[model samples]
Target: MALIDCIVLALYLIGTLAVGLHYAGRNQRSQDMFAAGGQSPWWVSGLSSFMTLKSAGTFVVWGGLAYREGVVAIAITTCIGVSAILVGLFVAGQWRRTGVTTPAEFVELRFGRAAVQLYTWAMMAVRIVSTGVALYAVAVMLVALVPLEPGHPLRDPASGHLSLAFAIFLFGAIVVAYTVAGGLWAVLMTDVLQFIVLQLAVLFVIPLLWLKLGSGAPLAPLPPNFFSPTSDQYTWWFMAGWVGVHFFLIGAEWAFAQRYICVPSDTDAKKSAYLFGGLYLISPALWLTPPILFRMLQADADPEQAYILASKLVLPAGMLGLMMAAMFSATASAISGQINVFAGVLTEQFYRRVFRPGASERNLVAAGRWFALLIGAALVAVALLVPVMGGAERIVLTLTGMLFGPLMAPTIWGLLSGRIGMAAVTASAGLVFLAGLWVKFGLDGPLGSPVLAAWVQANPRIADVLVGAVLPVAILTVAHLLRRTPQPAWRALQARVDAYAPTPPDEHGVDHAPAKVVAISLGASGLLTLALLAFNRDGRGALLVFGLSMLAIAWMAWRVSRRRPGPAN
Candidate 1:
């Protein structure tokens, strides 16, 4: 390893642990630890939320996608950006008012303790399996470049007896240490730092790639007629459908909700959403440019395979380590954030709310910590399953999108109307699962691969995008309509929940001030869209300038988070 590589990686890890320890005490109280006492700055939470939700799979997936389709990534990105803004306008108030520690907490409040337990466990299981695969993906890349514990299972066919499972464990251990040490606070702080560093690498890698291309470096050959807009990669129908699905998927569920939950107040939540979503619309380019440009420069280079090798060939030791560190942070923070959310569900809704109502608060918190460990272990065990997860590597967000799409549409509808029953919600969830399976079996089999495979060929990401968002929402809405009227108890509960809608701050100006926030937020997102357009039109110099500007804005986000007041809530 080069000195710069080691130094950057070392510094990143050090920062991660430091942030974790920094938040350790906050977690001593379960709510504060798990949910940050419901007072985190909305903007800070929004920034962290983006990083945590995006994942290491993003570069591999989005870049590969961009290389194939060009500016279409912007459409998908816009879908989520729009969805998030809707989430801010519609869903933020109810979630904030409920004063729940986690999403499962709301389940308990809306449904029952038993349902909460089941939902919590189900979410945890999916996350564990998914996170393991994500860790494994990184392991594959590492093995491709660095000789980390040689003969590692990351090598196909397993030479030298280094098990891929062990690499997952090692990585999981790193995430767990930080997660357990600092809790949400630590996760937030470090994520901002990671976002900054990762964005730097993202911007840096582009220029280097163009230089290489200009200098006649080895590269991948694009498919015949690759640049044609009529190519399957750039089909208008596919792009539109993809974006529309995410409109519900990203807008309603997943990590963006986590940000809404973290901020200090409803008004702050709105502003954060507006600001975050505004800029967020553009981040696809900031985060996605490196991989796409890398592929373009290496057009003759097998884009995916080239990226794996390019890091070793181009990035100096320190910068390589820095890039790796940024990657690890993005992945780890994501996993740990989910773990923390699951633990809160376990301790509050499942363990205490259901099984042990009389348990002391402190004991409940300890239980959450233990639950985190258990989930981490499960992830390690499932790392071996990565090879079989099938396109799980490319569709990390989609995987999660599947989980949220159905549930979120119903929840949002309920929150707005203030009358949804647990039975209806649960039924909606069932419908969601069936939709996902159908896509996996039907379309996936036909299109993903014609030959028989052990499991369905449908990538979870595609399922996440299509079946996850569309089918379930339609089914859930119909089911809700066809079902009987709300029960008296349900109405009462809804009333109680709505009673707590946090009053908007007078000075906060939910509509006006948040507009400024949205301008900044949307401006960043706009930049991404513009960059992609420029690149597609062969405006390489213009795209470079736009990217540099985003780097500045992202820096401002980091500074905002860093200087945010602790007592804002």
Candidate 2:
């Protein structure tokens, strides 16, 4: 990379660190550190959340998937777009309403101390492994693209075999340094700058790639599944799932909890969610197109490797370093956000609640920071020791599959299941989910799928999240009949949910009421879902999903329709 590009990259990263440190003292109260005094501007909070939700892994994997798997992959990207709207409608205002420092706090509030603690510890466990994954992604890419020297700890000094673990650890140190110092303020504030760099890097490269390799005639001669939804390789189930998976996993998530916390109020937060949805639409397009262009330019070339190659050998020297830095920002921002929240939840729920319920606020906050540090240190150790899959594509997918499917269960149930307690539910789900993923990734053998007894050897990180999420849903189903819920807890929560949620305030403040609002939401979801189903008949589903989503959103949003946010109770 050129000296200028290196300088720019270094300056940006250093500047991020500096800003984080700048706000280190802002945590006058424990809540401020995690949620920035609950007064972050709608725009800044919204943007930070959007960027955090979209990671380097996301950009790299999705882009690479498009190139390798064909246009059908774009449907998956579009799924994230829809998920953003769901977040706006369901998650945004309610998170703020809970009046908690972390998402796990909602568990404690809605279920009991036990559920919150269990979920928190489980989530942190997931975070440690997930962080390791993020580190691997950023580090491996750096090893391949940037100018790592032979003796560099990231690269093997002698044998030249990839020291996958060391690379992950090396990057972990960088993320923890900035994140531990700044907290959410540091993370979100730095994210604004990171978003600018990351977005521009991907955006600029796509055009250059296309310019270098013009688009050929319509890609009709490709394999049946190359881009066709109707093709065997691209079934409607998979296409439809892309929407479900990405929305829950990325867009509508507790992963970006601070974004909801930092908003001025719940109503404004809802606006941010919707607005961010629109912004999120462009990311996959930007991140995926370059590799596709590269492959078209060199038709016989290995499309899977084209993305990494272009970023490495194809871009101008300085731009390469800048791009690497942008990716680091993307990966780091996301990983640290997860780490910070996980740490906070672990402290408040497990450590403080179960072990030292009487701990002072100061002690709880201290625990949060310490836990983050310890987790960071552990991940670094894992990064230094664990062996990762050789190819980035295989490593990422296997990791995502393990986590993506199961994690959604908790969030979904949290939003929908009113009486079901989260503690036993989360614990059951967490165990089942992780075990399933472990079986899928390890015990399954060379492929790391769930079918084989050899799946025990699969990458454990991915296994944890996927199984953790999926198992909970299944367990909850049985638990619904067998496991008894606390009657008082259920009654108390229902009371809270009912009193707070209001009918949409039309131009006239009539009591639009719950029944009317429910009708609208159900109607909207049904219409769009049918439209999507109609895609087999001239792409009707493709055209109407957006309109239907918006309509369903309008109904779901009735609770937050008022601009004044009803005085925060």
TM-score of each: 0.79, 0.73
Model 2, residue 425: C-alpha shift (Å) = 1.2
20-111 per-residue lDDT for model 1 (tens digits): 77567766677677777665657567777667656665555555566666555545565567666766776775567665567765655566
Model 2 Cα lDDT, one tens digit per residue, 1-569: 45555564665566566666777776665676676666665666777777776565664566666666566566666656677778788877776665566777666666677665555655566556655656666765655544455776655655364454555665687788777777777777666656655765676576556555553433323334655433333455445544555555653245665677666567867877776787767666667767666555544544444566666544654556657777888888777787777766677667776799888767766777887788788766644432443444555555454555554555555555554555546656566655764575455456454444533344343333335443455666665656555446556655665565322333433222222333443344345334333223433432244335445545554544333433321
Give the number of the best model, judged by lDDT: 1
lDDT of 2 at 290: 70
lDDT of 1 at 108: 58
Candidate closest to the true structure, highest TM-score: 1
CA lDDT, every model vs. true structure: 0.61, 0.60
